[model samples]
Target: MHAVLPVAKPIRELHDLRPSDLGPGILASTEPVVLRGLVAAWPMVAAACASADAADAYLRRFYRDATVNAMLGPPEIDGRFFYNENLDGFNFAPVRVRLDKVLDELGRYRGVEHQPAIYVGSTTIDTCLPGFHDENRIDLGGRDALGSIWIGNRTRIAAHYDLPDNLACVVAGRRRFTLFPPQQVSNLYIGPLDLTPAGQAISLVDFLQPDLERFPRFALAMEHALAVDLAPGDALFIPSMWWHHIQALEDFNVLVNYWWRQSPDYMDTPMNALMHALMSVRDLPPEQRKAWQALFRHYVFEADEDTFAHIPPAARRALAPMDGDSVRSIRAQLLKRMNR
Candidate 1:
């Protein structure tokens, strides 16, 4: 029945996250790591605020009356509202509102077959500038992908993972984020249609009051879970495959996030995937299952040089080469096959 979760390191400043500052071997592994100052510099924080301020002000005013839009629409099944999914172009929205006027207009709009609103606004860094700092706009090309804004009241985004590593900057008001690593997917109490729960409307479990009796595994999942309260000018980085649940704390909570793939052209490792297929999908008779599992453990996860020498130098060279473009092309080709 706890409203918030605990974090081992409670960070208030950004400089604390520098990899060099944290010491060696911190980010060297693929495990989830939290960096405090990765984007704590004044330039980055101010830029994020500038990117989201206008839209934040608008949502605070319009969505303040929780009763008005509480159940107005069905849940959004597509998991792109909170996380940016690059369908084609950047999914950024520019929403504007006059606070005072919205407060007066809330009650009259009830009793209508309220159209579920999934607001997607458009903005160019130059045109939507709100003076967050001296020189505000960020170059999306330099950073691999652009930044975006999300604003709402008591709004909730479902559990899902993104291919890219993410940086979320909260400019105005406070918000809570509940995160789970990918390995805990089995115990997450996932929702309907293989789509996100509530058509992706609500998080699978009520974040504030998780029912341990019904979902006992969630307690163990919490051992690896982390929660962060991103305030104005504070940002958080979420690595790939880290499941996260977000909730707006105030009437208008605004967030702008920057997303960059770990490697733009890198593809999933086929050797690992094929191994998984052999165990899970390729069907082994009962007796062979144990043997296959043991063989896989020894040759794959725990494999040494003896098992891998079968991979010729040419194929190994194709995986990651000194030439950047060659590696990128191989990565792209691999992605195409996976999608097919």
Candidate 2:
């Protein structure tokens, strides 16, 4: 069961969640997790720079000097506007400057200096860059090679899932992210691959303003949506396939992130296929729609205790003792269906 909570600032504190706390079969909160003091020892923090100052400097550099490539996509139409679904291609360039130099310049406003930007790639960055865990620290942990940064002004990225799970760290300014569960593609009104309009670049959420009349279903989406404000040193982990909308809060806001897919293939398709099937088969069939609607109420909405009561001991044993193979197989199926 879900409770309606007033929207508030993102969580700034960090706490570990045991597997027990998460329970089984339930997903993590779709809301952003704020981890405070997570990056207290970061090189920038050691310089005693204000979050905004560090962010501004970092973002200015990223936007001004980073090399960027245009993302390609097919276009499509929704309600009225056409949308382009191109993803930006960028190259990550390693920085040769000292951290002290970068931090020092973070405080000053250098006017209109246009240095040729470097395109930074994701692979060069440290995987542990986003982790606050002691075991994942640099030297003892791993080094961050993330050399490039992305600076999109009014620009937007299309709706596509990332292979790597992303931990976005905001350094220079604030960004607003509109996210949807991977399962909500139908409700999202995704653009077509054949053709797309210009304004529908990265978001299905009407940015100009919500047209409640045309997109009434969006009201229901609001219930499922969560927004997070990212400040300096604050990082947000967007688990793979979770739809997201990212926007710069200021003209010079900058952010850096580390992305890597978990091993053995980080994808699922069967679940996606099942969802597609259900939407078409069950929802389209008026009679079955009502029946499955009740089923969803019992299992998802009401959480009826009787639903799993008949599980045999053998079945429970297998289900309870889940392993990597089971996870892989499930995810693989979901990924397969999604690609289709």
lDDT of each: 0.50, 0.44
Best by lDDT: 1
lDDT of 1 by residue, 1-340 (tens): 4433334233223445431243223322344444444434445344435544453344443233222111122234221343234322222332345333333333223222332223222222222334432333433334454455554444556565665666666655567777777888766776432333223322355555677677666666677777777666555667666788776655445566666664544445344575557647568687877787788787657766665577886776643333666767766886797779
Give the per-residue lDDT digits (tens) of candidate 2, residues 1-340: 1334334234333544321232212123344455434444455433324645554443333222222232221121111122323423212223444332333332332322332222122322222122222222322013222322443222334344553456665655556666666766665555442233322223454543556565556556555665676654555666667777665554344455655444444335334545565556655668877887787677656764466668875665323434677777766775798789
Quote the lDDT for 61 in model 2.
37
Q: Count clashing pairs, candidate 2.
A: 36
- In angstroms, give how far residue 4 of model 1 lies from its true place: 12
lDDT of candidate 1 at residue 296, scale 0 to 100:
70
For model 2, the superposed segments whose C-alpha errors exceed 4 Å read 1-32, 44-67, 70-148, 154-160, 193-203, 266-340
Cα-based RMSD of candidate 1: 9.3
Query: Total clashing residue pairs per candidate?
Result: 4, 36
